[model samples]
Target: MHTDSAAEPRLAGGPATGLVAALDIGGTKIAGALVDDTGRIRVRVQRPTPAREDGETVMRTVEDVLAGLAASPLWPGAGAVGIGSAGPVDAFRGTVSPVNVPGWRGFPLVERVHRATGGRPVTLVGDGVAMTAAEHWLGAARGHDNALCLVVSTGVGGGLVLDGRVHPGPTGNAGHLGHISVDLDGEPCACGGRGCVERLASGPHIARRALENGWRPGPDGDTSAAAVAAAARAGDPVALDSFDRAARALAAGIAATATLVEVDIAVIGGGVAGAGEILFGPLRRHLATYATLSFVRGLTAVPARTGTDAGLLGAAAAARTPRA
Candidate 1:
């Protein structure tokens, strides 16, 4: 829903000539916006995702979001549509199989959206890739020819910008850093892999590790990673240890990414990153130990500047510059 407090988007320099419609689909919400060529969103609408509903029901929500945008006076000006969706997405085939949205397995989202939008051309990319696009275009990764953009929240997701362009791979699932194994012989992951970074660093896992190591929640029963972060700030040993472990795992994965592809910066965002230095401090220290190659030693990690709008903005970016 549009809010009174939401400011109208202004161009950084001057107006752009054409406009595009952008959709950001995720487990929690679906957002739609009409964006100018300058990457400014002029109108927006959103709704909570009916994640547990059948595929048709979820599609209805998406339609409702689009309907809100179509009602705008700017509709006739939008020449194309871009969608950023949770994955694994097959951009080659215009199909998506997002893990969190079971009803959408192998769903032909691009075709469905094209039909709903009265035949406007559509482009699709993974949510991680979308974030990378946004960062590379206007945020922390801007001007960096090679960069890694990450979202560390309930789950860890990432994408790469190589040779000054977003790299979606053939399937739109490249730079999936969360699934990269940092500890080859350690515990198994939900993705059927062992020692995946998400298993050790996701918010739930961080809180779980703290609890297992003897940290207790407050009377409110708030056992979230935020609570653990607070405890760490207060000098709780168990909480600190949990964050440290997560930082080490992230450092290893980041270092490996740097060594393999040679990114200059790693821009991180999402809920867990709100912990501030509790996460970055150790991550930097550990990166010193793991990213040792002469080529990768200067690789740096920084917080993402793009806020909640990254998805919609990135979708708009993809529409303007369709990946080949």
Candidate 2:
């Protein structure tokens, strides 16, 4: 297990009292933390996810991470446990079926975690929703009554904030923008959709498109989207075109979401967002073309400020906020 003790002060408000045990479960890793109400992480632990292993093995990995957190002296003060997991999670049913972790299908994650955490009330939400909560609480989306927060990485994920509250929907997958089809006759997505935003804008797709269009990697043999961003910065036509296409798809999806939800701002995060202006420049330009409707024409996109700790912070926020 890995541990971090960095203390991040809240942007505003007084220091909060009490703590919540937060867990962020993804295909790559399982992270646990003891977070106070003000969004500070007092203690943290993480473990690599044995994603390819059997369900029990994956559960053990999570349990191990939790055990590490529980070993902390502050763990006894944790009043609740919160989990932000990859979709599709059924918060109503307290189950999770993350697409990348095939070993967990309808797993009773809430119950298992509740038992493991000494029966403290356990709350579960999709990773996308969790990120949204973090943004609304302490990042770029703060003070916005309605917003859409996105994570554009290996796969695209998102969540909504409506009327100044994080809205996870009934099953905790409300603002799932990536799966929305952008092309009626384009490539099929692993989510069984045709030409979804994820198929065109995700990091893997960005790199794949660059490679398919003759954008050779550097001598170091880096073919990631970040590498493509570097090539675009160096004025590579193929790399620039790949990012432009991805940005166009993202713009279309963002525009559609704005039209549907009337979100004033869209906060973009995750590894792919690290491309900076390479992605945002084209996305903003394309968004102008698509979001011409009077109400949505003013919609703006901004970078998420929560960084990598969004998942854990969001889970803590969910644990503290009362849900209806």
Candidate 3:
């Protein structure tokens, strides 16, 4: 999270080998790090995302993050660069069109990063795919051969792993559970879909539903899903109702995914997932009602263990994978 040039990172001991330069680009922030073979970040840098700026301006911010990483002594040992970007990304074309960062529409991110890194090979994947890579590598989905990893934050995003490998599909956007329509006659979603999981289970939607149900923010004036979670923990009916509805939507989506792919586990993360039992308790119960198939009867839902570093670590993990 250090934006100033004066901040110095703790350098790793000895000559670092198998190092990768990792970048996690999102609408909220852009994080960069030099990750070692052990998944430990040696040098780190971060900057606020210039989401509303022109494409070139956002690219400049990305370059700034790279510049900071390059300043670290470990830069020379890095063999390649891995990028996990908020998507709609096309890995084959090396282009990105993130929803929140409208400035980057079909932006040639791979070529730009390649040029910035002095021709070091670059690998790109959607943020959801990146998270899946991370979870499969070292988090809750480590031992599972098939699993779904989801991030329920300001938005809902997800990725899938099959046969012990991340499944990013041809366009690096295979497991986009957020846009999956769960209600045929429900509300329209921003993604031009109706009753999409994101429209129902995302942080914004959860809060909006609570507010619409006459739930008021506390003295802090905070009306985020986290606040609603706190209210639910305190036995507030409206808040609890909002979470239950989101959980139901999430359960339906997860069940549908499991039915299609036969995944054994669902790993949940991000801001709203901080609700913990308030979210998972109802989610598990609802999942039992929807995932009635024999193959999906044993599917378990778990919390992500990678924490906030999942994005950066996942990027590095992608770099180490063949063809990412």
Candidate 4:
């Protein structure tokens, strides 16, 4: 368990409007925060998720995190509870069935959390959608009326902002760009699809491609994508090629999205984006080849301003917005 509190000066006059209790739930951890209207996290707590455990056990961990948040003096002012969970989640059904957490299959997360928080209204959204909300509200897409926000990490996940509003779609997985097939005949993906963007652009795949292409790690034996990035920087052809291929695939997916939806900007975040210019350079170059349409040619790809706290802040943004 980990706990931290923001300094009082940041909260100062406090939120003009009350705070929102936010929960960011993922396979690795469950985090809780009391967030102000300005997106400041006043109180934060986290616990490693018992992802392999039974459904009830996982729920217990979430409850413990809530208990930690409830211990804060600001808890009483957090009138609404918002959750951003790994999906596929059914916001309409108030249930979540995250692919990484098999223990939860259509778990009634919203209802349980509502009960845990003394019946405060609970709003649910997929993690990607939550990240989009955060970006649209305060990050890279803040001034853009139409944009796509993506997280390219272990898996590629994304959400859309259209007409200045975050769109979660009906099932809360709207702009899920990872499953989009960029190479129709390349390779099968875990989502039962062929040649999905995630298959090529994910961090694991980047490292895998580099290793398969003879890019050996240095003495430290770190075989992660970050290590591959280091090798690429050192002018290793194989490492560079691997990232180029991933960049091409991501470019194809992003171009297709812009062509279909008219998004003016694509804000990318997550672990892989840390590769910096190593990935962006090729992505921009490849994008020029695919996004040739006059409408989409102007589309720009930029780094996401929101960092690790995106999930928590986005959940709070969702809690503040009125549901349609």
The lDDT leader among the candidates is: 2
Question: Which residue pairs collide in model 1, if any?
Answer: none
RMSD in Å for model 4: 6.1
Alpha-carbon RMSD of each model: 6.1, 5.4, 6.5, 6.1
Model 2 clashes, total count: 0
Q: What are the runs in model 2 whose C-alpha is more than 4 Å off?
A: 1-17
Cα lDDT over the full model 3:
0.88
Worst 10 residues of 4 by lDDT: 1-10
Better of 1 and 3 by TM-score: 3
Taking all chains together, each candidate's TM-score versus the true structure is 0.93, 0.94, 0.94, 0.94
Model 4 per-residue lDDT at 18: 81
Please give the clash total of every predicted structure, in order. 0, 0, 0, 0
lDDT scores for all predictions? 0.86, 0.88, 0.88, 0.87
Model 3, poorest ten-residue lDDT window? 1-10
- Write model 2 residue lDDT over 46-66, tens digit each, in one string: 999999998999999999999
| Cand. 2 Cα-lDDT | 0.88
Query: Per-residue alpha-carbon lDDT of model 4 for 163-221, expressed as tens digits?
Result: 77787876778899999999978899999999999999999999999998899999999
Cα deviation in Å at residue 208, candidate 3?
Answer: 0.3
Residue 232 displacement (Å), model 4:
1.1
